[model samples]
Target: MTTLLPNYLGGRWQTGTGAGSALHDPVSGQALVRVDATGLDLPAGFDFARRQGSAALQSMTYGARAALLVQIAQTLQKHRDAYYEIATANSGTVRNDSAVDIDGAIFTLGQYARWGAALGETRALRDGDAVKLDKDGLFQSQHLQVPRTGLALFINAFNFPAWGLWEKAAPALLSGMAVVVKPATATAWLTQRMVQDVVDAGILPPGALSVICGSAAGLLDNLQPFDVLSFTGSADTAALIRSHPAIARQSVRANIEADSLNSALLLPDAAPGTPAFDLLVREVVREMSVKSGQKCTAIRRIFVPQAVYGAAADAIATKLAKISTGNPRNEAVRMGALVSREQYQSVQQGLQALSTVTQVLYDGRAQPLIDADPAISACHAPVLLGARDADGAQAVHDLEIFGPVATLLPYRDLAHAQALAERGQGSLVASLYGDDAQMLADSARALARSHGRVHVVTPAVAQVHTGHGNVMPMSLHGGPGRAGGGAELGGLRALDFYHQRAAVQASPEVLQALGL
Candidate 1:
């Protein structure tokens, strides 16, 4: 019998009924553990978090909460090696990719801790300076942001089980909100273990942090008006979440990150054999191979000057040809398998849809796997496709394979490239590679209307610029339209999602006495 992973809820650990769903090793297809949330008292668990958990956390000043975050970060660092083991067995990720998730989570927590400590003993945030109502300074109006007396429910995606949890949780927790995490079932082992370690350490108040590892069927249904929901998943699921009574009728706060077909463009100035061109090729390959190209911010569309179309294609393919995909445990493998057989099938179907309008530039589907059985393991090689006519390839802009797949396309000039890039409707990011400062600035402004972030890579910052698809905590992470119209993780700006903003009208003396 597979060992059942317990769900932490209502200040205690409990097991769900039945055999539960088995979590399999993506490399060897071996069942490692089971998880289930059937028959758990979700309503009571949510009530516990709202009352006891909220009170405990809200009682502390921002400095005290910052101390708690530091302790949590240290605890996770202590068990870092164990987490790497789980990532290999369950997530089928290489050491570098695992660090992107596990280490990224810890770093985000620490960054938030440092920011929170700077906030000092303030319980509420003042929006801006007070204003006089009648220009006499006798009466004033002030806007204040206070923590909502409720819990935060996070529904995360499978690709980033570690970072997805903390990136959202860190901000919410720092704002004095208790957190309930529902990690994707396929890669829930690492998340569960981290939570277990933190809970056992007894560093946090009981009911402050909880994890429900299986079906999230009833989780949203138990939310109250003051509660907040943060989700990272498919657009279809995001739609369902938005229409749910808890969000639409009860007026609960929600932040969603959904489907994005991010793009990378080579400007007219970055011709073949130039440093900017080389930088573009390196970034494309890195984005496609990292995390098996399963990131929400990964580049899906590649646009380049029509003159250097063939050269760009050849360069990118040459680099991708060297990446070996197989079992992550093997020392020689550069990339690993998809999260599960279901995701593998999804990628295959997406490739077929894209093939109707594009030709294969570099096909790795026939490449042999290393140290694994093809009949069972969920491994897949990176593939590059090309479309001669960018405007006619509607499927290329419409579909996101959620795997190691990207389509290369051509554009006439900068204007043409910007138009083609906007075909994605809206995206999390759009990166421009070039040497001309004015050209990069003009292109970034044009793309900014539709993209949440505009990443410009010039020769000056090529060595230091963070790679595309990396969601840094210092910048905004969500996008406008098809990317879910939500915003998260722009320094202290993220706290706005968990706080309630209200205007208080009072006398100058009363406002001064209130201390913002």
Candidate 2:
């Protein structure tokens, strides 16, 4: 049996004095670790981190912090060869799926470190350059960044143990703030291991990173004003935490990155057997399979024009039937299990509910689904759908069935396509596929008002495109409406939410003279 990964607090391994819960391997359906979740000394844990870790991190310069971030990325990359196994044990995702969350997260942090280094320029940090002041030479200033003088809380989802943590923690660390990470109870082991590796690498200053493995049950209750909390999970959970009157009363900065009803549009131009048609099929398959369809960024809605609805559905069905699902180690396996039994049930529930609004074009319900593999903890086969009414559109538009499932909807016209995509209310991403640039651009402009991110993919640009599955470190990974109007990436802009920027004034001439 695999032993538990201990929680790290104040730069040390901490195991609570109680027999905790067992975390089973998602791939093997066996116990991986028995975590110590109860009796976590929260008051003591928070106190130690705030009193020591927070202060130490605040003293570091941005460059110093940036360098440390680079170091962690390199270290994590080195140890990442073994990460696939860890991910498989907890998530049951195929290698490709795991990479999207594990390796992808490491690469994202490396990118963030590079971007943060551009803050200082020769003109700003050099000795001679200056900015013109107020007319009287009495007021002038240069903008600079300071580490936010508070803490950052990361409450992550079970589906992405590594990505969720790194996306929030790395930026906060590089921006010079202490981080208190609360991993989900169901899948905290991988996060625990990763955090330990991060600490052992010595990238974090002592007390700068703290781990609370179990029940963050009451952690949010103690938050204060100006303190920042970033969460990546359910909208309901975010609602509960942000609703804690303390949040509004104190104006706490709560950033939520939840999965919303996102869509990928197959424009009227996608003729059967055309390149755009093929690209649309590939795009939908990739999103549904990547991360086992457990990503907040997954495309849950597949919108097709009324003329090609039959063709699109047939193409998707053919592709869905060809997908291989089973163990992650099985290289031929393009799709893998959902995160857990509970996750499997959740996806099933979503599909059952969506059926109420739409018809299943390809159902895995009595079919040979990946979930049938008893060796895995929670595996499910791919499911394809085509909807007939607003019931179908509204079901997919409203509910995010987080898994390898896509609900294809038909539209009467371009306006209707845009309207159907909008019915999801708000989304993180809305993708349109066509070789016609003008048409895609026009549709995007019309629907851009409803989505946070837009992608226009066509035969000409398909090879060079990042594809719909990739979320860059510099791009915003969230949306408005049911998607929880918040952002996770956008370079230093993400860090901005963590730090408070106050303008201080002094004349340029006075400042220059003082230096002399």
Candidate 3:
């Protein structure tokens, strides 16, 4: 029998009332554990965080909180190997992919911890200098940032169980807010284990962090005006969260990072055999294979100049053909299975939709598996498709495959490429490859209006530049329109989401006394 994973609530781990749902290993198709939260006391959990956890965190100075964050990072580092083991079995991710999620989480926490030292021990963060409100200058006003006296609720996606949780938890904790996490059911083992490790260490005050492993049936209904929800998932789910009566009426704060149809454009100057051409092909293949193209920021659409469309497509196909798919435990396997059978079927449905307007360049169904049975395992072959008509294939931009798949489109010129990219509505990221400075600059400026980050890769920086799919902690990772217009992880600016800004309209003497 597999172990039953309990939910953390009210300062203790509780075995809730239910039969529990079984979680499986994607590579072997075997049950590993059962998790359930049917009878979790939702209201009491939030109340404990608000009335007790919030108080304990608020009593500490920003520097003290930063110290706690650093301790958590250190603690996780000691137990990092255990997490990678679970991720490979449960998430079907290769070792490199697990490092991206597990190591990336620890690195992000460390960065935030060091960044907090600069904030000092102040409770109230002064936003700006006092402004003269009157001619005499006796009356002045200054903006002050104070921690919210509430809790933070996080709903994470399955692709990144560890990083998804810590990325939001780090900032919320640093800003003096308690956290309640709801990880995706398909891959909650890693998340639940990480949270358990932190809670068991006793480094954080009781109720500072809690996890709900199974159903979140009544979680959102208990939210208050002061509470904040940071969600990373489908856009349809984000819309539902926004329209919830409790969320809409109480004016509860919510930040959404939704899946988008991100694109990469190969400039006209990046002709065949050039460095820029090779870079674009290599980047696209990497994005498609890494994590099996399950990333929200993965390149879903590839735009190439009309002159070399066939060459670009052939190059990407050749690289993708070289990837070996199978059990993550195999040292020779380059790509692994999907997180679950449901995700595999979802990827199939996307392929069906795109087939109506595109032709297959490469089909995964024909690929050979290594060290795993293709019949029972959840592995999927990498697929590449070409638009039958670049100007009319709306599904290419509107539908999200969410797997190892990408659609190639041909563009006439720079303006045409920019227009084709904008058709995505908006994207979390867009990459442009070229040797011409003017073309790269022009496309980047136009793409910036729609994409959160525009990565420009020229022949000069191709060797040293960070790849297109990476989401750095120092940069902004949100986008406008279909990408969900919510900014996250923008250096120190991320703290604003967890703090309340208030203007102190008072005399200079009064402001000084208030520590402005």
Candidate 4:
């Protein structure tokens, strides 16, 4: 029998009733572990975190809390190889892909530690300089932000089991809030192990961190008014969370990251064979193959100048064709399987939906896998689809395959390209590639209205610019409308979600006495 991963809650480790749900290896279709939350006392856990956890963290200064982050990072770094092993077994990710999740998580924790240390020995943050309420300047009003006296509940998606947890936890913890993580069940082992290591090291105060690896059924139901919730998943589930009584009636804070059909555009200035055009193709292939295109920020729509649409499609296809998909354990395999067979089927269905309006520019469905059984493994090759008429391809804009699949679309001009890109409603990012400075700037400016981030790539910064899908801690990572109108991870700005902002109007002398 596979070991049922224990859930950490209420300052102790507990196991749920029954045999539990099995977590499988995506590449081998083998059961690795089990998780079940049935009969767990979730209400007690939340109360404990809100009380004991909150009090302990609030008593510490920002620098003290930062020290905890550094310790956690160091602890995880010691077991770095172990995390990669679990990721390959459970997430079916290669070394490079695993680094994006495990290493990214460690880096985020350290980054937050450095940023938090800069805050020094302070319990609350002053929002802005005090402003005089009257002409005499005797009375002033100052805004301040303090950590919320509650816990943060994170519902993360499957694609990034490691990075997703720490990215949210680092900010919340640094802001002096306790955290409860619900990693997606399909790939929960790595998350569970990291939490276990931290807990065993006793680096944090009791109840400061907890992990519930099974059904999220009753997790949100126990939330209090002061509690904050953040979710990264499908739009349907995001809608459910938004409408939950805990969020709607009780006024619980919520942040959501949902469906995003991000785009990448090749500007007309960089014609065929130019550095700009080549950069666009290279980036697209990287985005599509990395994490098997399961990234929420991955580019779904490729828009190129109508004159060079064929060239861009062929170029991207040529690069994608070289990526070998199979078991991550194989040294030669460049791409791995989906997180599960269910995700594989979903990708197939999404492909069928797009097939109505788009033609297959490059299909890797027939490509042979390396040392993996096609009948059992969930592996899938990268696929590239094309649409001749950008405006008429409604499905291309509305649907996302959530796998190694991307569609190529042709635009008439820069204005048409911007318009086509906006059809995604709102997206996490839209990248523009070209050498024309003015055109790139104008297009980025226009795209920013609909996209949370507009990445401009020129020949100059081609090597230094971060990849299109990478979610750097220094930039905003969420979008509006269909992409879920939420914001996260912009340096210290992420702390805003876990803090309560209030403006105190008082005499200048009284405000000065408060010491901000």
TM-score of each: 0.99, 0.92, 0.98, 0.99
Best of the candidates, lDDT? 4
In candidate 3, the residue pairs with backbone N, CA or C atoms under 3 Å apart (3 or more residues apart, or in different chains) clash, namely none
Q: What is the lDDT of residue 195 in candidate 4?
A: 97
Q: What are the per-residue Cα lDDT tens digits for candidate 1 across 1-516?
A: 889999999999998886688999998899999999888899999999989887899999888888899999999999999999999999899899999999999999999999999999888889998888977888889899999999999999999888888899888888989999999999998899999999999988988999999875888899999999999999999999999999999999999899999999999889998999999999999999998998999989999988898999999999999999999999999999899988999999999999899999998777888887888888889999999899999999999989999999999878889998888988999999999998899999999999999999988998789878998899999998889999999999999999999988999788777665
lDDT of 2 by residue, 1-516 (tens): 557667887567878676777777666677877777466667676666666776776665566667777888888888886777788877777777788888878988888878766653211122234455677656765444345566788888887888888888877877666888888877887778788888887777777888888664577776767568888788888788778875768877888777678889888888888999999998898887787788877888888877788888888887777777776766777777777777878887887887767777886544554434554457777888777674345556778888888888877888888888888878888888988889988988987898888988989997898877688777877788767788777776777776665433567655564432
Q: List the residue pairs that clash in candidate 4.
A: none
lDDT of each: 0.92, 0.76, 0.90, 0.93
- Count the clashes in each prediction: 0, 4, 0, 0
Tens digits of per-residue lDDT, candidate 4, 299-365, equal: 8999998899888888988898899999999999999889999999999899999888999999887
Q: Give per-residue CA lDDT, model 3, range 226-335, as digits (tens).
A: 99989899999999999997688998898988978999999888899999999999999999999999998899999998888788888999998899999999999999
Task: For candidate 3, give the lDDT of residue 102.
Answer: 97
Ranking by lDDT: 4, 1, 3, 2
* Model 3, CA-based lDDT: 0.90
The true-structure Cα RMSD of candidate 1 reads 0.9
